[model samples]
Target: MAATIPIGPYHVALKEPIFLKLEVEGERIKDADIKLGYHHRGIEYLAMRRTYWQNIFLFERVCGICSDAHTTCYCQTVEDVAGVTPPERALFLRVLVAELERIHSHLLWLGVAMHIIGFDTLFMQIWRDREYVQDLLEIITGNRVNYAYNTIGGVRRDVDEKTIRLVKKYMDTIKNAFDKTVEAILQDPVIEARVKGVGVLTHEEAKRYGVVGPTARASRIASDIRKDDPYAAYDRLDWEMIVFDEGDVLAKTLVRVYEVYESIKMVNESLEKLPPGPIVTEVSRFPPGEAFGRVEAPRGELVYYIKSNGTNVPERVKVRTPSFMNIASVKPMLLEETIADAPLIFASVDPCVACTERVIIVDSRTNEKKIMTFNEFMIRYGRKRK
Candidate 1:
């Protein structure tokens, strides 16, 4: 007989509200199903109502960890639709902020993973070191979490000489601490025993499932949007895409740990090579057209689509976050794993459920289901007044 275990909607191990149904026989999971949509905010519908400028802030709230990535992709898509290009200096600044956010996000995810494995001491240490990156972000962007750094044509702020020096100083500090931490994590016998050979997703499965970011890289897929499709200063900067062939939980950990070092290097280089120019360009009007933009976010590739109608507001706004792609891969990872290892295997993906929600409402009275576009939903159910 098989017993079904439910983890989430809300659970101690989960960071956000996601429902997982695990069918287990004995201690081994026979099958798994993931359910989302509990955290949907209808942001696409909301974006259609707000001006292009306002949508920058709106999209940033998609996921606190990937906030800057959201704005970067959103602004880039709008810039594409409007036929504008950000200044060279702004592009470097964008890369600086982006890499810093990546460092912070990976560190936060590492801490969470450590905690999931009952390694509270390491979790505490990792989170403590994460503050240094946060402080560096605060120094540059003014806020640690939602940086509000990106704008329509370029970044909202500029990095001065003092800020550049501070970034360099902090990068050195972070790298030193991070290197030691990585060494400890990789050498820990308990961690190695727990994570190695667990939640295996082979390269073929990774490609088949269309995983992205560190998940795909851990499987030796070599699919990074920053490298695949050049954006901001990524093409100009010198860095390497970290890849591993193990495709297990430990591989995922090592990939992220190595990428942190790469991110630090990219930040330093961007700062050293920071050019001189205006950060933003003025855009008078948006022509009627549609454009798509994407960025390699901390988790993976985040995509934004914008349709313009020769107005200040977007005619349509659609987002497809990397979590949407990576979360599905968890189903394959969870199969045949123990219930005890479920949380760790799931967390290995660094999923952001709130960032993956797409809402659909069904009328129970008639058992009728209609997939409506943003415009249709607005016109049909939107509040009306005389």
Candidate 2:
């Protein structure tokens, strides 16, 4: 007989609240179902009400970990609508920060994955090294998590010679420690036993489900937005996308591990070649049109679509975060796997539920079954006193 096991909205295994329903027969899982929207913040509707300049900060908060990627994509979309070009120096600076964020995000994932696998010692070590990247981010952008560095016309800050030197210095630190860390992970028998051949996502399965980022790359699908659809300073910078064909948890880990090196290399090259110019530019207004922008976020491809009506505020603002695309692929990964491996398999994608969903309230008092939009709910609740 098969029994259903529900893990989260709140469980010991989850980093965040995401409900997973698993049908298990003894130790093996027959199938799985995912429930999202538990962490929605109504961020897309909030973006429509805020001006283009203000939305940078708002969208950045959509995902605390991937804040820079959100703002970068949002800024790129606004730049398209307003027909504004950021200075060359600003473009390089944007790339620098984006890569740093990628390193931080991937390291964070590594630490969490380690903890899930009962490798707490490595978890602590990964986080300790991750601080080097976070400190660099704070020095560059004035904040650790939400840098608020990106603007519609350009970046908000400039890099100095001292900052450039610091970047290289820290890259060296990363280089020194990275090899030993990877060696320890790869040589560990426990990790190899737990991860290899577990939660396999075949190349065809990866394409059918439309997975992205390191997850897809691990499945031998060399799909990276930075390479396929170049944006920001990615086209000018030389870096290779890491791909592995095994498509298991171990492959995902290796893909992210190598990616950290690539991101550091790109950042170093960007800083070296950063042109001397202004960081911000003047954009008078947004024309009546629609535009779409995408960035290769740490997790996957983060996309933004915007429509303008010649106003300070946008007509429509839609964000498609990477987590949204990657979460669906988890269902297939969970199938036929034992319950013991479920958490690590899910964490392999670096799932961020808060970035992907929003609230929808249904009125069940009269059983009328009315689903309230966020805008309507706000207006009804936010009416002014007469």
Candidate 3:
């Protein structure tokens, strides 16, 4: 007989709220199910109520970790509909902040990974080094996390000579420390034993699941929107898309570990090739049209679709986050794996529940009057566990 185990919505291994129902025989998982929608903020509907300009701020909040990517993607879509081109300098600045955010995000993931593996010392070191990137972001964008650097027409702020010098300085700092950090991770026998061949997602499986970011790259898919469909200043920059055939936990770690160096190179090159011009252009109005925007966020490819009906507000807005694409594959990765490896495999994808949480219900008859706590709602919905 198989026993069922529920891992989240909230658990010691999960930082966010996503439930995993695993059926296990003794220590090995036989099958698995994923459940989301614990927190939905109705961002799509809110976009319709706000003006195009206001919606930028609203969309930025979609994922706190990827806020810049969300806002950038949203603005790109809106710009496409409005037929407004941001200045060259603004584009480079946008890329600058985006890369900085990538460094911060990847390091955050690295810290969390170390914590997941019970390596608290490395976790502390990684986060400590991450502060330099955050400091650089604060210096340039006036805020650390949500930056508010990207606007519809262009970037809201400009990078001064002092800040540009500081960026180069910090990039050098990151480069100096890169080899040591990677050595610490890859050379350790313990990390190797825990991650080497665990949670293997074959290349075909990655394609079938439509996985993205480091997860797919670790599978050697070599699919990246920045390379395939160049956006922002990526067309002007040159960088390699990291890939590894192993497609295990270690491969995923290696892909992201090296990506930090790639991002740093892009940031430095963008600054060196920085153009000078107006940061933003005047926006008259949005004509009726539709446009799609895609960005290679730190996590993966993030896409946004917008339709405008010749109004200040968008007619419709849709977001397709990378986490939503990658989370489904967890079901396959969990099959036949021991329960001990479950959390690590899930973490290997760097799943972002914040991006995927949503719920909707429709009733044709009349207005309903009922309010219940989440526990009651779960019980009423027949989710009570045996």
lDDT of 3 by residue, 58-143 (tens): 98888888899999999989999999998899889888988989999999998888888889999898888899998998899898
TM per candidate: 0.96, 0.94, 0.92
- lDDT tens digits, residues 140-253, model 1? 899988989999999988888998888899899999999889988988999999999999999999999999999999999998999999999999989999999999999999
Note the residue pairs that clash in candidate 3: 9-18
Q: Against the correct fold, how does model 1 do in TM-score? A: 0.96
lDDT of 2 by residue, 93-177 (tens): 9999999999999999998988999999998999999999989999999999999999878898888889889889999998777
The best candidate by TM-score is 1
Model 1, stretches more than 4 Å misplaced? 363-386
Order by lDDT, highest first = 1, 2, 3
What is the alpha-carbon lDDT for the whole of candidate 3? 0.89
Clashing pairs in 1: none
Identify the runs in model 2 with alpha carbons over 4 angstroms from their true place: 359-386
Candidate 3 TM-score over all chains jointly: 0.92
Instruction: Using TM-score as the measure, name the better of candidate 1 and candidate 3.
Output: 1
